[model samples]
Each structure stands twice: as structure tokens, then as C-alpha cells.
Target: MSDIPQERRVVTAIPGPKSQELQQRRVAAVAAGVGSTLPVFTARVDRGIIEDVDGNRLIDFGSGIAVTSVGASAEAVVRRASAQLQDFTHTCFMVTPYEGYVAVAEALAELTPGDHAKKSALFNSGAEAVENAVKIARAYTKRTAVVVFDHGYHGRTNLTMGMTAKNMPYKHGFGPFAPEVYRVPVAYGYRWPTGAENAGPEAAAQAIDTITKQVGAENVAAIVIEPVLGEGGFIEPAKGFLPEIVKFANDNGIVFVADEIQSGFCRTGQWFACEDEGIVPDLITTAKGIAGGLPLAAVTGRAEIMDAAHAGGLGGTYGGNPVACAGALGAIETMKELDLNAKAKEIEATMKARLTAMQEKFAVIGDIRGRGAMIAIELVKDPATKEPHPEAAAALAKACHAEGVLVLTCGTYGNVLRFLPPLVIGQDLLNEGLDVIENAFAAL
Candidate 1:
């Protein structure tokens, strides 16, 4: 059905001559601040494989950091976006409104969690969506303080950087961030100071106490969080944690915001990870997979909260670009037609089973967590101590890359090997990638 071969093939060494040349060019042309997980130059990407310039077909487990959940070359996305491209590239939606943008907004209203009358504003990246969400929340609640969790990652913008928890790489040296942003502990089950069973109640109580004593719940505008933490070791908060926080927000009149940028769009088995706990956020920010592979993001939320922003208070020159909107429509169509949510569940089952089995063999796997296609394994030196093994994670990823299997590592400690294979990837190819990962662990 797909033209791209659903298999892994290594014709030359990883980052072979052509990719090496491109890396050199990238060094010259690209900013040093811009970093890439893998240096292989892509010639084509379709379904579950990324073909390099050297003709190496690597089984892709990164999905361009979970942006291609509907596959890089899904027919619907290509057909609709291509049609739009031939007509017009950009009129700047604010300058001259377009049907495509409105259509996308309507679709997001229906697709995102909650049946309440909703509205949406599009943006160019996850960070922009998050920033706008905070703006909208503050406007609606008429408050200034914003609350985020320990492992949460919102975006790279100054406001988001202040909201983000990690310091190195993201927040390092980028100081004097926005004010009124508060950080609270996340109920990370594996690394919780207390046992997993106690993580939820303990963290929730502590967070609520902190908010009450320090920020004053009355002054808090929003409680923003990722349903499943991304780029922070794919940490899934302990059970009951989200509901507790949501209850607090509801009781305190604080707008609850779900930063589903990396965990939405059917990547988490459910349409959005918040659905897992039946939490209806006042606002939800989305990107990464919203427009297939196109750069688009949106803040979809309760109509009342969304409308709190005055007319012309929110928008971007490139927000909801016609072509990107078309891609989003196509992507949503593909998601429904193909039943990608079910596929994501299947992917989760397969990945969890395999990773669990590998954990039995390799004690370095401290934890295997995440939902559906957004899975990861945290690496550690000893199971007892649970000391992060970032070096091993890096080494294993490198080995997988060398063997024509593309993987990514992420975490606060940089010790997580995250797997975000395209949902359309064949089972055989998926298993092969796992095999490569297992072999990498074995070699280590």
C-alpha cells in the first residue's frame, strides 16, 4: 500500500560520507545553538522509515519527535496540502481570513477533549500555543500567578522557559525569565522520594500547600501540566495525581491547562492523555502532530475562557496558514479513517511488552513508562540505587543509530530512550527496531 519499503537497510556506515558532508555544511550554516539528535541527512521519510542520503533506510522510532504520527507521507495530508499549495501559499489569516483556518478550528473543537462549547486560536509552534494559553488563562481568571510541575516542559520562549523546570540546555543562562511563574513537584512514580503508592497524595498535598502558602490560590491564574511528561523521561504522573490537581484548580477557580503538545493527537492511545483520567481541562495546547508534519499549533479551550481575550488580542501572521490547515484536515481525516487511536494502543501494548521483557534481561532499564506510541525507558546504573545512567542511554541510542535504527534519548537526567515510531509503522518493522534496541542493550 505504501511506496516506501517498510524495512530497515544499512547500505553504509551511519552518518555516511554524504551525511557527514551535510553535517559539516550544517555546522557552517546553522546556528550552534540548534542541536539535532541524529546527524544523518534525510533524503526521504515515509511511514516508519527515514532514508538517508547514503541510502540507509533506518527504522524511525523518533517520528521527528512525534510530529509524524499519521506518517510523514500520509496520502490525505499530502493531497490536501499539495492542493492548497498550488492555489496560494499565504494571505496571512489575520489580513484576509480563510476557510481552511476556520475549518481547522472547528475540527479542533470537536476533536480535543470535552464537549463544552469550545474555541481555538492557531499558532506556529507548541511554545506559541502555550504562551497564548497562559495569556488567555490570565485574562479569563484576572490573575497573575501561573503554576507548573517539576518535570513539565512547555516551550523555549522566555515565558515558557520560566514555566519549564529543567535548567540545563533549556533554561541555562536564559535568566530573568517572566515573573509570577511557580514550580511545584510532579508525582513521578519511579523517582518519587516516597514509594509510588504515596506519590500522588503526597505530591498533591505538598503542591496545594505550596500554592496556598506562597502564591495564594486566589491569585493563581492557571495550573498548567503535561498529562504525560515529555522530554523529561516520558514520566507519567502517579495515578490519581492529575485528578487531584484538577480538583484543586476547579475548587480554586484556577484555569486548568493541559499542555498536550507531545501527548495529544492520538499519540497517547486516547485522543488526548487527559481523557485517560477523565480530566476536562479549561484549556489545552497542542502541536507536534496536529498537522501531520506541518508546523502548526493551537490552543483549544472552553468558549468562555477563550473569548476572554479581547478581539485581536491573539493571533500570528502565520497562525493557521492555509497549507498547514489543509494538512491538519488531512491528518484528522487519516486519523479517523485509519483509527489511529486503536493503532496507538496496539503500539503501546507491543512496545510495553517488549520493553518489559527487555527489562527482565537488562537491569539498567530503571523504568518503562508512557502510553501508546509515546513510550520510553529510563536507564539507570543499579536497580536498587536507581542512579541515572545517561551515558548508557546515549551509548545505546548511538548503537541503535549505527545499526540503522533511529532512536532518541530524553529526560531531566538525559537517561531516557524514547520511542515515538509513526503510528502507521508495520509490526514487523517495529519489532525489528526493538530487536536493534535489545541488541544494543545486550552489547552494552
Candidate 2:
């Protein structure tokens, strides 16, 4: 359909002939420190499968870290982007505003959950969107401190890194982090506080109390959170936990900002993860899948809060690239046409059934969590003991890759396997990918 080829494989080994040669060249020319998730360099990809340079075909469960939700190489996306390219490429929006940029902002205002008069600002990446959100929050609330939770990942930028929780990889040697960025415990049910039964509002409340008591809520600009924690683990925060935090922020005049970079664009069954709880945040940061893989991110919020920033205070050199905006328009249309929200629920059904079955048989699977297609499996040394088994998780992922599936490992301890398949993936392909994972874990 539309030019995206149906599933087909032409190569043998994953890094077959051409890919290996290129890999050697890449090793010599490119940075060796950059890690490759899949050994094979991609020649082409569509829907759920990646065709390596060597012609080997592998099912893609990573979805480019949840960027291409509709699918890899979506036809409509390609066409719309190509059409826009023919007309014009870049004359930065700040230099010369265009309808495409305004159109995308309009779309975001309408799409993002809120009835209040909302405004939007575009950026080039998730990190940029996050940074801008923080800037706006500080300006709006006139406070210095920003509160983030444990296991939360905002981005890799300096300020975002400070807001991010993990240490080894994201923060390791990069900091000296930003000041006034506060860290609090998330409602992680699996590793609940001493006797806290199930991660609930009380767990979140405890964290809030500690933050307010230590940092003083009056000094806090925003309480930033990922409705469903992404890199930390695909752990959905406990029920009522988010609402409690949102209320606390409102009561204290703290800006409630939802970092929906990984959890937005129907990846979490709703248009946004925050929708599940009916929580209306003051500001929401979005990126990744917003433009069907192109680099575009945004901050959408109430008009007054966003306007608090001076006219020149917020913007980027390439904030709303024309091509990216076109791609976003196409992506938005594709999501609506395909009813991706419904597709997400279908994905959850498939994932829960498969993962639940695997958990029933494998004692290593300590937890099966997430919403919609944004699912993950937390591995353990012993299910009863609940000690994280990072090595086992790495081994299982390696096994799955060899068996023709591409998955990713995340979480603070690197013991969780996250699945972020394109929403357009065929059921058969999804099942086949899950089978690879099952076989990998079962064999272990």
C-alpha cells in the first residue's frame, strides 16, 4: 500500500556481508563508543520488520525507542514529507513563520487533553521541549526548584540530566548537574517502601511530604513527572498517586508538568498517559512519535502560563522546521485515520496475554507492567527474592536478537526489557516477536 513494501527478507545473517563491511568502516570512521542495539545496519524497514544491509529480516520491537509508532517508513508519512520538501525545506520558523508550523501548533492544542485556552511552542527534540517547559514553569510560578521522581528520565541535556534520576549512563560523568533540581521517590509498587502496601496515594504523599518539608513547596517551580516512567522502567505510577501530586502542586501554586515524551501520541492506550487518570496538567512536554520519526517536540499548556515568558524568551534556531512540521501534520492525520488509540488497546491485549503467559511459566519474570503497547518485563534473580538480574536480562536480549527479534533493555539497573512496537504492526508479526522473547527466556 502507498509505497511501503510488504514484509520480505533477502539477506542471511543479521550483519550479513554488506552490513559487516559497513560496520568495519563505521568502526574506523565513526565513534566506536556509540552502541548499536541491533548488529545489522538497516537497509530498509516497514511496519514491524527491519531489512538489514545484508538482507536479513528482523522484527522491530524497539520502534526506534518509541519514535515510529504508526510504523517504520509509513507511506502516507513519506508522501506528505516528500511533497512538502518539493515546495520548500528550511527558512527557520522564527525567521519566517509558516502555516505548517501554526497548523501543527493548532493540532496540538486541539489534540492534547484540555478544554481551557491552550498555547503551544515547538522545539527540535524531547530534551529541548523539556527544557523550555521548565523555563516556562519557572517564569510562570516565579520559583527556582523543580521536583522529579526516582527512575524518571527527562532527557540527556544538562538541565534535563539533573532532572533525570538514573546515574550510571545518563548522569555518570556528565555532572556537575543543575542546581534547584530536586529528586523524590516514585510510587514504585514492586520496590515499595518498607510496609507500604501497593504503591498508592499514600506512597506518593510520603514523597511529596519529604520534598515539601525539605525543599519547601513555595520554592518549587514545578513537579515534573512521566505519567508512565520510561527509561527508569516502563512502570506506571500507582493509581491516585499522580492525582495526589497534581493536587499538592495546585495547592502550593507549583506548576504540574507532565513529561509525556515517551508516553504520549497514543503509545499508552489513550492519546496521552495522563488521560488514564483524567489529570489535567498545567503543561505537557511531548516528542518522539509526534512527527513519525522526524525530530520535533513541543510544550503545550495554558495560555497565561505559556505567555508568562517574554516574546523572545522561548524559541529555537530550528524550533519548528518546515519539513518536521509537515511530517507532524501527516503523522497526526495517520494517527487519526488509523484510530491508533484503539490500536493501543489491541496491543495491550496482545502484550498482556503473551507476557502474562510467559510470567506464568518463567520464574525470572518478576513483573509484567505498562499500559498499551508500552510494556516491559522486569527480570529478577529469584522471583521470591526480587533481586534484579541485569546479566540475565542482557543475555535474554542477546538471545532474542540472534533469533530474529530486536528489543531494548532499560531501567535504572538495566534489568527490564521494554517493548515499543509500531502500532501498525501486524498481529502475526507481534506474536512472532513475542515468541522469540518467550523462547529466549524459556531456554534460559
Candidate 3:
């Protein structure tokens, strides 16, 4: 539907001369710690394709790290955000509340899980939303301890860095994290000490036991989890894991928070991934895909818990800026109009079938997991050992990039090759991208 050609066009080599030049400029200007998966500077994006500075069009498998679920150039999103931009860029919503922000809150309250009376607060990024959610949880419960799962990625801020599990890129050398944050085991099936089938009940029991003995469930303010783990290799917790956790939280006074930042907003087949098990949380944090690639995030929760915070305790200068809110409203509209949830299911089926076939052919593919469009393959050196093979993941991503497909790698061990194509991607283009990945694996 978009005027831009929907096919991958490699007129030049990956990270061609123009991108190389830009990369050099970036090295000189940008911070060293900030990295790029593909060093190709983007000139434009049309639907699921990213046209780079060198005029090569690449299929987008990473939607700006799962932010652009409605596609970058979605008509309604562009139209509404642009209209807001023309009207006014930013008046500081804190100084003068706007209709757009309230509309976004209303949309989140309706869309996020739970039927009980709910309230919503908006923020600039996933990290900010998480920080506020923690504050709100503590305020409501009058507790100090916070519990997070291993292999979970919350964000990069000081507090969230403490909550995250990865070491190298995210939490390395950054120490003296905020106090009172505790880490417990997640239902990482593939790597579970025991077999994966028992990972659900066993891991949940272990985690709950840890909380009960060490952290004391009564003193814990929040138990935050990503229903479908994102940066930690797209690990979907075992079947019985979440329900058990939710039950314990309800039994105690602890707030159960679903950090649906990366997994929310139809990135999964459902509007939110938590719906798969019907496990609703006390507070759900959402961002990334909420605002058509704009920087917007939200914390929607029960009214009693949300109201625990003072009137001015939950806002920021740029939180829910009018332009970002307009984009969010437009994104919600697009999701409904296009029925992206169904599209995500279609993607899941296609990916599961093809990747399962790949697993049959390749010994390195130890696991193929994830739900909806947020799928991944865990590579290992040996099937029996299941030793992490970050090398193969790196090589496969590079091969896909060489053929004009933009793929991404993640995981605690960096052995996960994640695919997050835009929901609006043409079936033909998505297949072509998958074909390139298949070929890349064949080469390996």
C-alpha cells in the first residue's frame, strides 16, 4: 500500500559507502557505550522496510527494538502526530494538562488487562514508567522490598539497571544499584536445571520459597515480571508459573506488576501477552509499541493502588507530550482498524513452522520459542550439552544483514536471534525476509 517499493533492494553492500561515512561521524560524536546492531544510518522507513543512507532497502525484523508495532509510517499515526506537531510541540503537560494525554490514559485503562476500576499514568520511556510504578507500589503497600526475575530486562536507568539481569552490555561495571531490589529465578525452560516440562511448577515454587524465606512476602512491595521475557531471549515462562506467582501475590499484600514494556501493544497475538494465561497484574507497565515509535510509556493499575501516590508524584515535563499522545491514540486506532492481533497470530504461525523446520535441519538450534511476532531461536554448540553459542547467533545476524534483512540478537548469553517484524509487513516480504534467514542458517 505504501508508495515505497516493498521489496528488499541491495543496490550496494551492507553498510555501504554512505553508511560507512555516517558511522565514522557517529564514532566521533556519539558516546562509545551506545552501540548499533547494523551500522547503516536510516534515511527513511516505509512500512516494514528501512531505506538507509546508501539507498539500499532492508527488511525490518527489528521494529526499532519493538517500538513501531503499527509500522513507522502508519497513516493515522503520521497524520495525527503531524497535526499535533503543527498545533504545538510541547507546553509541558505538567504545567497545563492536555486532552491528548488523558485520552492516552483512557485508552490504556481500557486496553490493558483487568476489568476492575483502573487508573493510568504516562511517562517518557519504559524506564521512567517502571521507576514510577515502583514508587507507586511502595507508596500503596508501605513496603520496601521489590522482587524481579532473572533474565528480565526492565531498562537502563539506575533503578531499572538494578532490576535487570544481563551483565555485559546492560549492567556491567555499573554497581551500587538501588537498595531493596532482589533477584529470583525465572522459568527459563531451555536452560532449567531440571527438564523443561517441570520448569513451571518447580521454578515458581522455588521463587515463591525464596520470597517467603528471604524477602518475606509481607515486606515485598512489588513482584515485576515480563509475561513474555524480551531481552532475555524471548523466554515464555512455563505454563503454571505465572498463575502461581499471581496467586501468591494476591494472597500476600505484594503488588504483582507485569512489565509489558516490550511484550505489550499487540507485539504478541493478544493486545497484551498476559492474556495468554488470563493472569492479570495489579500494575501493568507498557511502552515501546504504544505510540507509533514515539517516546511514550504508561503505568495502568487499580484505582486504589494508583491513588496511593500524591497528586503531583507521578508526572514529568515531557511525559505524555501532546504529540506523543496523539501518536498513541493514532496507534490504538490503527491496531483496531487493521486487526493487528490477528496479523500477529499469522506471523507466529509462519515463524513457528519455518523455524521448526530450520531446527530439524540444524543441530545448532537448541530451542525455538516466543509468542506472536516476537519469536527467537536459541543457538547452542551441542544439542546434548545445550551450550550457548553466541558465535552462531552473531554469524547468522551478519549473514541476514548482508542480504538486506535487518535482524537482531539478544539473550543473557547473547545466543538469541530475535525477529520483530512490523505488524503491517506484507506476507510476501515477511517470507522473503525469512528465506534470507534460512539461507543464512544454511550457510552456517
Q: Judged by lDDT, which candidate is best?
A: 1
Better of 1 and 2 by TM-score: 1
Q: Judged by lDDT relative to the true structure, which candidate is superior, 2 or 3?
A: 3
- Compared with the true structure, what per-residue lDDT tens digits does model 1 show for residues 98-126? 89999999999998888899999999999
**lDDT of model 2 at position 153:** 96
Tell me how candidate 3 scores on lDDT. 0.93
lDDT of 3 by residue, 89-109 (tens): 999888977799888888888
Q: What is the lDDT of residue 129 in candidate 1?
A: 97
Poorly placed runs, candidate 1 (over 4 Å): none
lDDT value, candidate 2, whole model = 0.88
Give the CA lDDT, 0 to 100, for residue 353 in model 1.
96
The list of candidate 3 runs beyond 4 A from truth reads none
Model 2 per-residue lDDT tens digits across residues 12-53: 766577888888898898886677887688767888888776
